[model samples]
Target: MAVSLTGTRISVVALPWFVLVTTGSATRTGLVAFCEMAPYVVVKAFTGPLVDRIGPRAVSWTTDLASATAAAAVPLLHVLDLLTFPLLLVLVAVIGAARGPGDLAKEVMVPEAAEHGRVPLERATGLSGVVERLASTVGLAAGGALVTLLGPLTGLAVNAGCFALGSVLVGLALPRGTGRAAEDPAAAPAERSGYWRRFGEGLAFLRGDPLLLTVIVMLGVTNFLDAAFASVLVPVWARESGHGPTAIGLAGSVMGAAAVGGSLIAAAVAHRLRRRLVVLAGFLLVGAPRFLILAADAPLGAVLAVFAVGGFGAGFVNPVLGAVLVERVPRRMLGRVNALGDSLSWAGIPLGGLVAGAAVAAAGLVPILLACGTAYFLATNLAGLRPEWREMDRTRGRDAVKRRAPA
Candidate 1:
């Protein structure tokens, strides 16, 4: 997961810059992003049942290989003078399509990995979050340097290589019998029940859990804000401030480093904490402050300080969410349920890039940043006031989750 995600973080920098410089238009940069993430969200929603059936291990390795192929082709074709804007869009779409299931596969495998290591689930997930932040730190710095020194294509090629290496690791490094589909009472007979039925079961489970629904809804709004901030607002800010891509990378790296420290603390003690309070507190720090800081015309030092604080707060989030899902969803239904939940939360990601670009074009950077910051503040704070959020602190186990009716 770290290997693949690191490469993805690099592309996060390389791909946007590639489009922005080439087109000299923020709209097209976001259009390219839309071309990628639209397929990611749509395909991931429908991929749940398939991941459950075919198994996440196979899905992980194969789709990663496909992503590598598509990612590599962009630079290769560009070098050959065969890469048009349309062709680049098509390749990125393929990468995104492949990535959706591949990423889900990795997520589905997390519990199995935890069990194999004999680690507590919350700690394991916290460790996973740490890996992600570390990836962002290393990959963003490397991406910035690669783009600055060697060009964006070089960074894209490195992403391809990372994907390929990740494929080899997933295919070979896991223990025997580790990545097989989870077996349950529904397993044998459900083979004949067909895909839509399985999908419906997952949806029904999610709908019955108001807490999970609330979490997903709140995350959907915040994810939209976050996606916009990362993909457009920061880049534009860097350009406007004459700080360039290096500053963007530095800000990300500093935040990511702080997040790693936060995750380490969470791993040691978050399980003992009241999850509802931690989550609300984390969201408070992670949500709106970064956007407002960027809009403040503050020095880079001030921006980095706010981002580090936000990053520290971010450290508490994923571990809690991962532990919640693992505790509430049966392993057999994990792929479908987790997939649906994540897809819903991520639904606005593509639109985030698109709307941020269009919003900035109309209103300019500072106004859009302020508006987005306010929206983010309202989303998290208001969501925290809901009764369902209290369930975040309730204890749950797979046995308890299974006792809940499929209805």
Candidate 2:
């Protein structure tokens, strides 16, 4: 997961610059981004049932190989002077389409992996979060340096290499029976069910669970806000502040580094903490402040400080969420349920860049920043007050009962 995500982060950091430098148009950059993410979300939404049916391991390896091929073609075509804007968009779309299921396949394997390794779900998920943050830090920093010193294409080449390596690892490193749906006898019969029927089952389960629904909705909004911050707001701020791409890399690396530390702490101690308090505190720290700080136009040091705090808070959230998700959803429904949930949470991402670009053009940076911050603050804090949030703490009791029960 970390290796694949690192490749993705590198591509994300480099792609906009590649488009902008080549076409000299911000609109084209946004267009390319939209082409990638729109297909990603849409494809992922429908692929969940397929993942459950065909098995995550096969889907993961195959789709990763596809992504690697598409990614490699970009630089290769560009070097041969055969790349056109339309061709680039098509290739980007291909990558997005392949990545959608590829990512979901990998995600649905986490719980199974944790069980196989005899690790607590929360601690395993926290370790997963740490790997993600570390990957993001390294990838973003490397991308920035590569783009500055070599060219954006170098980053793209590296991204292709990462995807290839990830595919190879997934194919060869995992145990033979790992990630196969039939490994779970309870879920095996469902593999014979039609895709739509299985998808409907997953949907019915999700719809019946208020806590899961609430979590999904809250994350949807927050993910949108975060997407806007990373894809649009941060780049604009860097340019406006005369800090350049290096500063963007610096800010992201600092935030990611802090997040790594926070995830480590969560893995070590979160099992002993109250879920409600930890979740609420984490959300409060994670949301709004980064936007507000940037709007305030504080010194670079102050901005970095706020981001560090935010990153730390952000780290606690995913591990808790992941554990909650695994507990609430049955193993048979995990793929479809996780796909639906994640796709919904990520639905606004494609529009984030487009919306931010339009809003900035009309209303300027500070107002947009303040508006996003206000929205983020309200969404996260207000959601915590809902009754469904009680579910966050229920898992421990349920687990204890199961452990004490006869096999």
TM-scores, each model vs. reference: 0.96, 0.94
Model 1: per-residue Cα lDDT over 251-365, one tens digit each: 8888898899989988889888988888889988988899999999999999999999999999998998888888788777899999899999999998898899998998999
Per-residue lDDT of candidate 2, residues 171-214 (tens digit) = 99988898886234544455457788888888889999898899
Give the best candidate by TM-score. Answer: 1
Error of 2 at 283 (Å): 2.0
Report lDDT (Cα) of residue 258, candidate 1. Answer: 89
lDDT of 1: 0.88
Q: Provide the lowest-lDDT 10-residue window in model 2.
A: 398-407
Residue 329 miss distance in model 2 (angstroms)? 0.9
lDDT of 2 at 210: 92
Model 1: residue 296 alpha-carbon error in angstroms = 0.9
In candidate 2, stretches whose alpha carbon ends up further than 4 angstroms from where it belongs are 182-191, 399-407
